[model samples]
Target: MANSDMCNSVGASPGAIQAPPLPAFQPRSCFACRRRKVRCDRQSPCMSCTRNITDCVFPAPGRATRHGSTSAQTPKRKQAHLLSRLQRLESVVEILAAQVKGPAESGTLELDGAGLVGQGIGKEGRGSALDDKTARLGEELGLLVIDENGSVYIGNQFWAAFRDEINQIKQVFDNDDRQGDIYSAETSSLNGSIPSDLTRQRREDSLLFLFWQSRGQDVPLKDLHAFPSQLPIIWQIYIENVDHYSKMLHVPTFAKRIQDLQGDFSRMTPGMEALMFAITMSAINSMSNEDVKIKLHAEKSDLVARYRTGTEIALTLADFINTTELDVIQAFSIFLDTVQTMESPKYVWSVAGLLARVAVSAGLHRDGSNFPGMSPFNIEMRRRLWWNILFIDGRSGSDQIAEASLHEEMFDTKLPTNVNDTDLDPSMKVPPITRNAITDTTPILVRSEL
Candidate 1:
């Protein structure tokens, strides 16, 4: 009777709903399991990947997978995300194609294959900013290129620069829209108002943090941050040997300018700071075992760390992105030459692009002789900077999408006269351009038809 009563009680209760049974035939195996030649639990990662601590990726739906079988196994959201990426790629290609075929007479673009275009501006627009912001964005994104005639275009190679790095960065940062909103707000506020005392403090703190992160800990922060009286010796070493390796800098001018600055790190510009550290590091690299490597208990490695730290700090402190100074270009040029790595080809490619854009923004790409108020010394400096950029581009290898931004054809700027900084005064009349072999000059002028 009890059994009968219990059976009746159980039957009276509602039956629990069960998930529908999975199909007896498996749709597809997980990638790892298939590769291992084993069966899968048909779970997202399956047991094998979970056991091995590996990522489990499945083929997208509506495609034939590794086993030669089409599976509608991908989630709806994933399919949508992939579709969005495809759309973006298509849109990018289309926009580039339009820009490439755009009317040439509509705007003036400096054709070093960097797409530095200016619209609605007259002849002066070529050097002055008309579309600098757009040009910078394209440069930063590695999307655009200009030809020898200042013709702009976009090509397949645009996406190739740092492609792996971009993917990895994307993985770490999924919500770009949110980040963009925050950035816009920050930028607007920064541009609209003078920074408060608190804001200044925050900035200082951030810079300090950056310095600390940049190898400041290898030695006393003060040692790394401040320029010492003895710093000139290291710079002297670098300047003397610089000509043997590079023609990007005018050694006499650079040395004299360093002397003029008089070891005041505080007064030094971002470009100067970058150049200082670059030279210091180069000097350290060039040192022999017999030479003294220790100063204030700081070894060569410590000094190197200091210079590297100082370079980054100075770059940020001087607002390198918005400001384009000749000093900064020289710094980047030297830094590029000093640092060697397996990843240099890709890294230097982007850097070369940046230096090119900076040169264009400064109007160094154009002939300055036409400008009425420009000094002879200033014109000579601009010419020197432009040619130096061309040399750097040659060494670093320009982006695959475009040739180096500063081309020989567009540059009508006269070559710098082969004269020492001390001999040529700013007040003196600028010398006429002459061939190097006829003048018996250094390899810098003699090697090329400048």
Candidate 2:
């Protein structure tokens, strides 16, 4: 009857659900620690195991795991091991957090592999800013840097000249859409043939058509000086760096003429046009890519390409080879100077020889003192040119890995007067006597002396 009662009780719970299978236990303590009832550092051979000189083994997961099983560690030892693992996990998480959050919150950008990154701007926001506003627009340590807000920063060498006006000039940037994109033809096959000349009907405007004739195509006149607004920005860069060093242009008069004719390109002589393009090209060449981005908000390579093409077109229009024009030669000189470092030595050598030939033909090699009819002002300008040509020739030779194109006896042009710009007026009769110790002219004087 008792056996019958027990059977009835066992059958009574037949409808009840069975318990889920127990998961395997992953042991944290090494075999040595488990045997000695001690903690394990969980290293390949734990510290305690190392000191005791015993075999260290980790427990592997298995299907035989059970809370009631007597084959493994006591509950207290298992709990201690679990606690140690939790602490290690927490510490790793903390180390990861520290690595993610460095001190400064400012955004920064790194461009190219040159390591020239721009410092980022502040990230603080206004009342309307989103909660996730900490994200940056762009950040880099470039030659020039801009932040999310579009504030620009350039190097001191360039900024000193135009820092006062670059902000207001952003209004001019709105008109950037007006400028046409310069297209570069990418061809798979070689096309060496030149396009035929413009029609006779189109050639009615001979001078205008002449500019395109030598360029070997029918080009729009409006395309000649594309960005008129950027004239001030680039002109300032040229005057500050190149003109200050070269002393080629008479700043007092030349600056005035440029300002007057700036609004009217049709009134500009081809020689002057060439000079403008060459100056702007050199101005760009003097700057880093970053500086171009901040000031012009354009790529350095693009600006150089456009202005260089313009220079070639303008020089062709001026008939630079056959002309006795000072502006054309001066333009040639400036263009050569700008390209000396940027172009291949072989190419620069060829251009340098071309400049030397034009300069010699213009009598720039002879001393101004040899001419009786020339004014002191003309003499001074000629002296500057003569010496500059020689300098260019010497540099060109160095580019070609050779000596100067001309010997000492070839030209006797004296060094330019050390007088200030104020001293040499076209209306002046006698030359200024005393040379100023410090003037804008002072630099070119030192260069000539060298």
Candidate 3:
């Protein structure tokens, strides 16, 4: 009896027979709540899951925590990094929300295509939404400064965008064994040493070649011109990639004139000079830096900057604001096409406005049919130029700026005919019949219809 009573007392007080303690009760999140990254009540069907009408699924029970579990011993560095990342994500969301809400409140948001004007847009919505946002963000961040002379200082903010891009490129090359050597070679090339692969194809008469010859000196008038052997390639790229949709030039006629010029710029007018520079710049702008290095042995940035400068100088020489030259207007409009994507919207809009005013004074807003002595060819070309001016003005304007450069009722010039470029000639005495079928101007025509 004594032995039995002792055994029962020991069993009742037993530490040796006790079960191990489980982890603190972890409230199970339903699959929907977990997916949404929200807290969940440990119900069969969580509120979120029920509200969302999702399948209420619970994860299987996990093993209870053991000593020295990783969950309890996570490094402070990792936790800090995670918290920092979350904070950055929240900041980005806040900035984006502000951008969206600001535009909405002002009713000045401009979409990509300005073809749809006036469903309910207000008078204040005359400028580009992008321009408004750009101005707002730039001022707030101290990123952009516009001068009285219209020069924009955005170098600091411009490069800020490339921070992540450089890292991305570095990440791609990080795994390579030759990263140091690759970087060294790139550094050498950037330090004015020509790449070995590019040296063979480099020509003495190339535009970049000319730029190199005058690197630290004032370039002479003659040096601004080029007789590069790769003219055919640039022409090909322009006609296919650029002119296909723009329909700015009468390709067949312009090609013939260029062929006749035979790289001679001694007799070229200032307006013509600007147009040529714009053409080359636009072509180079369309190509990749690597591609340009391979073909022309020049830095793409250098080429573009030089030609853009040249275009500005030539326009100044032509007195674009006062002088009435068709070529000058054409050159300015084409340069706008190249820069509208890169330059400030305000600057582009300002220039586009000037172009429209000049165009109006030059009688481009009127149909050539209203003029009695205009040749058939001149009339057609004039129509093309007028429509192009209108389109460029529309493209550069904001959705909610003041009175835009273009208004539909302000011009009487008709849409360009859908006739092929080959059919129209500088010497054509009779007006060519318009075509019902698709032609060279079909792309422009389709856009015009819109």
Candidate 4:
């Protein structure tokens, strides 16, 4: 009885000792109250949650404490959003990869027989809604630059850097190494399907015959010296306006070639005339001011007329597929860029492909070392012409057409030396050959890298 009395008396004073302060009632609100920012009413189920008929649960039961506050939840929400965007980006990449690797898989893509002008491969308006959103995301994420006109320009440097980061993310979703095999199969399928011998020969013969018939035998040769007075203006316009667009011709070399002709217009080959006219036309067409273009077009109407005429004459005179003249290739290359007869970009692309085919026919893809007694000057000129064709093909041909007639692996021509034309005087003991690294600075190194 004494022990029982002692135990009972020890805790007897604590019976009404404030019930341990009721956990201090620091307002640990329900989820609905916190999210909606309403008053919690300090109940087990808050007034806001009960009124909204929600679960009335707290995300963090001790959310009244600093560690469980809004500040602590912000980073988690942000992380979730970032994760969602990354997943979307991966989905876009997979679609594009499928398109590139296997065209048949891209059901939305409509391809022509030539496979040059496909609807969805690189063109707008044919992509899926997801693709459109991905393109918008590209702008938001800085993969593409959007101008005020809404034109998108892919930044190669940014792409190279971002590609590495995206590739890391790709590993999380895609583990298949079969993409390489798929791409290789696509390429082989393109290359493996060869025309029959008769078909190939017929095609070659037709192209040759077209060149043969284009030459108007009864047409009189237009005297180039008749316009010697206008030549200075043409040269000036070419240097100022057109040369930057395509740096295929060297001024000093052209000047030397002209001097060697000794002012005799009759001595100029048909190919040379075509080249001159093409340059003149390009300079006239590329005038920046609208008024100036109109005035120049009216004043140079004769010159404009001669551009097509001269190109036709050159093509007529040359043996075409059988001819191996570097000037013929050069003339056609500039002509492709200068011709305004066709407004479609695909026209220029197809013409550029034709020029590439002619170049390959001339063995320009091979090193000059294989040719016995080939001059260093001729070798350099071949290198220049080949690289220029590649540049044109890549820029004008691939960008719009999405098909390349010339493949880099099929060619082994070395890049021309980066020296200026005067420095490369071939007459002076075959000007000393100096090699540049593939990555070295050059006025036209993009084609070489490609």
Query: What are the per-model numbers of colliding residue pairs?
Result: 6, 10, 9, 0
* Residue-level lDDT tens digits of model 3 in 183-279: 1112222323466547432431232331232344355555665455767777887898788888888888778767777877766777778788778
Candidates' lDDT values, in order? 0.52, 0.60, 0.60, 0.52
Better of 1 and 3 by lDDT: 3
In candidate 2, how many Å is residue 430 off? 1.8
Pairs clashing within candidate 4: none
Model 2 segments more than 4 A misplaced? 1-221, 399-404
Off by over 4 Å in 4: 1-219, 223-226, 260-263, 288-297, 300-302, 340-342, 370-372, 399-404, 428-441, 446-450
Where does candidate 2 have its weakest 10-residue lDDT segment? 181-190
C-alpha TM-scores of all predictions:
0.49, 0.51, 0.51, 0.46
User: Residues 109-164, candidate 1, lDDT per residue (tens digit)?
Assistant: 33444233323112433465535543443233222222222212222234442243
Alpha-carbon lDDT of model 4: 0.52
Runs of candidate 1 with Cα error greater than 4 angstroms are 1-222, 225-229, 243-257, 260-264, 288-299, 340-343, 398-406, 432-441, 446-450
TM-score of 3: 0.51
Which regions of candidate 3 are displaced past 4 Å?
Answer: 1-218, 400-402
Tens digits of per-residue lDDT, candidate 4, 1-450, equal: 999998778758666453333332323445576566444554656666667788776443332324224343244543454476577567645643433333343223223332222222222333455445444423222111112211122222334434434543343233132111000012222333465666554554455443332344444546422266556666777776766445567677886776676656677776676566566666665655553445444445555555555555555454344455666677777766666343466766776777787776665765443332345766667777788788777767555645455665556566777655545555654633564543121556554676
